[model samples]
Target: MTIKKFQGRTESEASEKAKKELGENCVIMNVKEIKPKGFLSAFKSSTFEVTAAVEEKEKSFDPSTAFKNMPKAKSVNVVANEKIEIPSFNTSPVKDRVITPAEPKADSAISMFSRTKEKEEKELEQKISNLQSRIDDEIIKKEIEAEDKAEEQKSSENRQPTKLKRKNENFEFIKTLYEVLIENEVDEKYVNQIMDEMEKVNWGGNNVDTILSAVYQKMILKFGQPKGIDISKKPSIVFFIGPTGVGKTTTIAKIASKYKIEKGKKVAFLAADTYRIAAAEQLRTYANILDSPMKIVYSPEELNGAIDEVKGYDLVLVDTAGLSHKNETQRADVKNLIDSVDEKYNKAVYLVISATTKYKDLLEITDTYKEISDYNLVFTKLDETSCYGNLLNIKLHTGAALSYVTTGQNVPDDIEVFDTQKIVKQLLGGR
Candidate 1:
C-alpha cells in the first residue's frame, strides 16, 4: 500500500492531476497552501492548496491468477505479477461506520492497510483532516454541536408558514376600533343599523378613516339636527370632541364664523389644541380670517376663566384635542377636561365628524368622544365625500341633533346651518 501527495497551480488543477494519476474515484483528504518556490514569491506569491488523496490498495490475489483475470479496459494497465502473499483482515473496530471496501478479496488487504496507515501519525492526521474538511458544516467554529447543526439544517429545509405580522396588526387595529365603538355605548340600534348600511359597501378590511366616516354618517343621519338650541340659555360654552383630524378645529371656525357675521352675534374662541404647535397655528389662522378673538387655553381652568371673561359675547366655542377613541388614557383625560368645563359653565357639547371616516371608526369615535361631548352633531368635509349615507346613518342611529354642516375650509363660505333636506339631497348623491 502507498500514500501519495500531489500539487498544482490551483485546487481544480490539482484535482484533475490527482484524477489523472490515481482515478476518478480518488477523494480529496487534506489541502494546505505551500510557500511558492521562485523569486517572484517574495512580492505576493500564492499556490493552490491541494490534496490528491486515495484509500490505498488492499486485496488478496493468487498473484498470477488475479492478473490473468484483470479487465482489458484502456483505463487500466497491469503488469504480470511476481510472487506476493496477501493477509487476512480483522475489521471488528470500524464494523458499523466504515464504507464498503472496493473488492471482496480487497477487504482483508484494506484492513491491514488501514492499520499500517494509522501508525503513521502525520499521514493519519492529514487523511482525517481531509475528511473533516469535506463535512460541509462551516458553522462549527461557533461551538455548535453536530446534532444541533443537523437539526437546524433540517428545520431550515422544512420551514412552516405563519400568519403575516401586517395582517395580524390590521386585524388587531380593526378589533380595537370596534372596542372603542362598543365602549362609547353608541346605541346598539345605531351600530346594527350602520352595519346594515355598510353591508352595501365592502367592509373586507380595516380602513380606520373610512370606517369612522361611515359610523359618523350613520349617527348624523339618525340623530344630527339641533333638537333645539335654547337661545335663552346662559353662558353657552360649546365643547367639541372627537378623533384627531376629523375637522374639530375647522368645525369650530365654521360655527364661530356663522354667529359672528350671519346672526351678527359676538363670538369668542378658546383654543385648547395646544398639544401641537401647528394645531394652535391653524386655529390662529382661522381667527385672523374671521377677525374674531381667539384665546389659547391649556387646561379646563383657563377655559372656565375665558368663559367668565367672555361673558358679553353671545357664543363661546372651546376647541378640544383631536383624540383617538382607541386610546383609553387620552379619552379619559379628555373626559376629565370636559367635566372640568361643565363644572363651572354650561357646556354645549358637539361631536364634529368627517364624512370620509369609516362606519366602525365613526362608531368608536362617537362612543369614545361622547364621554366628553354630549349635546349635538356638527359634520364637516361634506364636499370631499360621495357617501351621504353615513351622515343619514349616524343621525338616525345616535339620536344627537345636527347643528351644522361644513363643506370646505372657507370660513364663511364652507359652512351651512343644519338643513336636513340639503344634507339628504347630498346623501342621496345629489350635487
Candidate 2:
C-alpha cells in the first residue's frame, strides 16, 4: 500500500500517476492537495507547478512478508524538475530511522527518550487507522446483513396465501367425503376421484365426517391409503392448519386430552398462533384442563429452540393462525411457522373442519386447503349435522385421511376415533 498525493489532479489521475511509477497493483491509501507555488508559478497553469508525490510504505507494510502474494517492488525515481516541498504534517515520514529496543544506559538515555516519544506517536497513529478500518468493515457487514433480511421479508410478503376460494359451494359434498377418505389412509388420487363423483352429484347439507369416513373406507378397500410417514417410533409432533374460528385450538385440546388421558401419552402444547389476542389464551385454557405443559413461542427462532428443549414428550402439538381459506400468502406464512419449527418432527398434520358447514362450502374449504394439506382431516360439530353425506363428498375432493372425528364442543366426550362402519350406521340413524 502507498499514499500517492497528486496536486491539481482528480483521484483517478492521482491513481494513474502512482501506477506509472509503482505498478498497477500499488494501492492508493490516501491523497492530499499541495499549496500552489510562488506568484509566477500560479500564472503558469499549463506548465504544471504542482507535483504528485507518492511515498512507499515499505517498513510499515513490507511486501516480502506482509502479504505472500505481493509483487516484488522494482521502482525507480523519475526526473522531474518541480521541487517538492516536504510538507511538515502531523505524520512522520517513513524515512525516519527505525526505533530499536536498546537497553537504557546513562549515555544513551536522552537519545532513547527522543526515539521513544517518536515511536509512541507513530504507534498511536497506526492504532487509530487499524481501528477505523475494522469499524468500517463491521459497518459494511451490518449493512449487507440488513439488506438481505429486508429482501427475504419482502419476498415473503409478496407471495399469495395458499387457501383457495370456495366458489358457489357446489363441491361441498365431495370435500366432506374427501376428508374421510384421507382419514382411512386411502390413496390421494382415488380420494380425488370420489370428489369428482361427489361434484357431479353436487348435493348440499351432507354430514361432513360420516360421509367422509364411509367413502374413505371404500377408497381404502379399493385403492389403499397414501403412504403415511411412520411416527410410532419417533416423536409425535403435530401442526394444525385451516380457516379461522373453526375450532383449531379446541381440536388441539381434544387431541391432547384424548392422548394424555385415554391413550396415556405424555403431551405438551406449543402455542405458535400468537396473532390473535385470545388464541394463546384459548389454548392455555385447554392446557389448564388437561394439566399438560403449555408453552408459547413468540418468534420462529424461539419455536425451534422450544422444540429442542421439549424433547422426551410423546406428543407435541403446534397451533397456527386461522388464516382465511381464500388467502394464498397465508400458506407461506403458515409454512414459515411450520418451517420455523421442525415439521419433519411432525408425523401428521390435522385439517380440522366443522361438520355443520354446508357441502359446497366444505368442498371449497377442502379444495382451498388442498395445496398444503398432507395431514388427516378432523371434523368437528358432528352432533350438529343430520345428513352425513358431506363426509363422503370430502373424501372425493381432497385426499387427506381422517385422524379423529369430533362430534360436539365437549372436551372429552365429543371426540372419537374415526371408525368407518360405525360412523356410516350412525349417520343413517341406525343402531
Candidate 3:
C-alpha cells in the first residue's frame, strides 16, 4: 500500500487533489482541517489535509482462495487497508495456549502463502502502533492549545468591561460639565457652541483630566485677550459710556486712580455727564483726591474745548452720563461726545456694564451702544452676583475686548484686568 497526504483550501478541494494523485481506488485514511495558530491567525486562511492510501497490484496473489483453508481465530478480525488494534495475550507459562493440527507440506502454495500473511499482519500491527502514538501526541497537543486559547479568551473578556466603564465615565463627566455650565447661567447657545467645539477636537485618550484641560483651553481662546488703557500716545482720551446705574462714573474713578496714583501719570478728568449733577460731583471728588484737572462738557463743542484744555495731559478719562438705551436723544449725545475728540490725539471707548443685569437687558444695552461707537467692555459689581454669564454674553454680543472687572466700590483696589482663566474655571464649577 502507498500512502500520501494532500492539502487544499477546502475539504472537497483536498479530496479531489488526493483522488487525482492516488487514483479512484484510493482509501481516505484521515481528513483534518489545518488552522493557522497565534495572534495573527484570524487574518489568515485555513486549509484541509487528506491522507489517502492505495493498494499495489500483485500478480501471484489470488484473493478468492487465499484465506479459504485458514483456521478461524477467537479474537482477531482483519479488514483491508484499515488500521486495526491487536489484542494483548498473556504469555506466562502457566496460561492456556491453543494447539492446532500440523500444517500442510512446506512445498505447498497454501503453506507459503500462510507464512506471508503472518509476516504482513506483524508489519501492519507495528505500523498501526506507530500511527496511534503520533495521533495520541497530536491529540494531547491540541488539547493544551485549546486550554491556552480558553484562558486567553477569559482574560480578554475580563478586560473588556474596564474599557467600557472608562468610556461611560467619560460620558458622565461631560454630562456633568454641561449641567454645570447651565447652572452657572451660561447661555444655552454659547454652551452648545462650546460643547460642539470640544467634540471636534481629536484627543487620543478620552481621559477626564485631558477633556477638562481641553475645555479650559478652548474657553480661554474664545475669551480672546483683555486690553486695558493704552497710554503710549502723549494724550489718550478714554470714554466711559453705558446705561443708567451701571457704575460708569465709579469705574472711571477707579481707572483714573490707577493711572494717576499708582503709575504717577499726568491724568485729567472730563465729565460729560451734564444730565446728572451728582455724577459730575462724584468724579470731581476723585479728581480732587488725585489733584487732577476736571472739566464738565455739555455739548460736542464743549467736548472739543475740554479736549484742548487737557492737551498736555498724558491720560484723559471721560465719564459720560448713564442713560436709558431707549432714549434716542441721550444715545445721540453720547455718540457725539465720543466723536468730538480731536483726530491728532489717541482715543478709546469703554462700555461699562453690570454683572448682575439680566441677560435680556444686557443684550438690549449692548446692542444699543454698538451703534454709538466701537468700545471695550468693563463689567462692574462682580461681588453682587455669583453667576458671571452676562459678562461672557455681553462680550460675545458686542465682540468687544474686555478691559476691567470690578468686585466692589473701592477705587482702584476692587478693579483688576479681566482674568479669562478665572472666569472659565468658575463657569466649569471650579473655584
Candidate 4:
C-alpha cells in the first residue's frame, strides 16, 4: 500500500485533494486538523490533513521453467524455486531501516471534522463582535462631532449683531450731527468723545432735535463762564503777553479805556516792549487819549521803578512785547523781564490769543508763555473768522480762565467779557 497526506483549509477540501492525488480507488486512513504553533500561530490558519492509501498487489512467476526454455545464444538467465543470488562489484556494507505508517484511531476522522466546524463557528463569532464594536465607535464619534459643530455655529451667530428695527433710526441722526460739527471746524476727537458719552447714557429719545438740545446743554457745562477781575488789591498790576498779530496792545487799550473812562478808576500804562519800533508810540497815543500817565522802561530795573511811580493809581497796565514762541532768545528775555516784577504789587497776567490762529499754534503759544507767567486767557479777532472752534479748542486744552474776547478793532466797543452761552449758541449753529 502507498500512503500520502493532503492538507486544505477545511475537511472537504482536504478530502477532494486526497481523491485527486490517490485515484478513485484510494481509501482515506485518517483526517486531522493541524493548528499552527509558535511565531506562525498569529498568521497561519488551522488546516485539515487527510491521510489516504492505495493497494499494490505483487505478481508471481515460474522462474525455473522460463530459464530452462531460454535460447542458448542469449546471455539472460532466470532461476526457479532454488534461491538465486546477484553479485555486485562494490564491497561497502550498508544497513537498511524500515519506516511503518501508524494505524488510524477509531472514529478520529469524525472527531477532527467536528473540531474544525467548532473552530470556524468561533472565528465567525469573533469577527462579528469586532465589526459591531467598530460600528458603535464610529457612530459615537460622528454624534459628538455633530454636536460640537452645532454649538460652535450657535455661538458665532450669537456674537454677530443682527438687523435693527426701524432701520437704525438714531444712526443717521448722529451721523448728520457729527458731520455738521466737523464742517464747522470742531475737533474730530472732541466730537467723537461727546458722541461716545451720549451713547453711554442713551440720551435724546430717538429725535435729532432733542439730541442737539442735550448736546448744547453739555457744551455750556464744558465751556464755563469768564472769571471777573479782583478789586481788593490796590494798583492791581495787569500784564498782557502773547504771540504777534494777536492784538495784545489793542486788547490792553480796551481794558484801560474801560477802567479809566467808564469806571472812573485811575490807570497808568508802562511799555516794556522795546523790540517793536511803534509799540511804545501806539500805547502813548492810547494813554494820551485816556489821559493816563505812560512810561517807557528800558530794563527790568526801570520796569520796577515805573511800577513804583504808578503806586497811587488804582490799576497799572503793563503791555509786553509780542514775540513768537519759536524765538528762543526773545521768549527767555520776556520771561526774565516779567520775573523781575516786585512781590509788593498785586499782579494779574493775561495771555491774548487770536481766534483766527490755527489750533496747533494757539496751543504752542499758551504752553510757551506758561513758563513766563501764570495767566488767564483773552481771545482776539473773533470777528475775523467764521470758525470759532479755535476759541473753544484753546480754552478746552489750556484750562485757562477766559477773561475777555475782542470782536473787532474798536477799543472799548469791540471787547466783551467771555460769555459762555453766546459762544455755545454760535457753536451749535445758532445766532
Give Cα-based local distance difference scores for all models: 0.64, 0.62, 0.81, 0.76
TM-score of 4: 0.59
Clashing residue pairs in candidate 4 (N, C-alpha, C atoms within 3 angstroms): 64-80
Question: How well is each residue in 1-431 modelled by candidate 2, as lDDT tens digits?
Answer: 23334433455666676677666666565555444443344564432122333444444434343334333323312122212122122243243222222433523653454466557757876887788678767877988999999999887766422112222242465554456545543346655665665544423434445545555455444322433223474466688888887788887887788778988888888888877868988888888888888888877678767776667787888888888777777776766666665655655677878877766687787876666656577777777766555665575566566666777778867777776666655433444
Q: Give lDDT: candidate 3, residue 291.
A: 92
For candidate 1, the 10 contiguous residues with the lowest summed lDDT are 76-85
The candidate, 1 or 4, that scores higher on TM-score is 4
Model 3 misplacement above 4 A? 1-119, 122-149, 201-205
- Candidate 1 lDDT at 24 equals 81
Ranking by lDDT: 3, 4, 1, 2
Please identify which of the two predictions, 2 or 4, would achieve the higher TM-score against the true structure.
4
Candidate 1 wrong stretches, greater than 4 Å: 1-231, 342-344, 426-431
Q: Each candidate: RMSD to true structure? A: 23.1, 31.7, 13.4, 17.6
List candidate 2 segments past 4 Å from native: 1-231, 426-431
Per-residue CA lDDT of model 3 for 1-431, tens digit only, reads 65667799998899899889768999988999999754446799999988887775543434334444233554343333333222113232221122211333423453444456667888888887778777767877998999999999999999888777877887788789889988888888988898888777633347889889988998888788999999999789999999888898888888888888889999999999999799899999989988999999888888877888888999999999999999999999999888888898899999999999899998998899999999999999999999987777777777899999999988779999999999999988998
Write the number of the candidate with greater TM-score, choosing between 1 and 3. Answer: 3
What's the CA error at residue 33 for candidate 3, in Å? Answer: 31
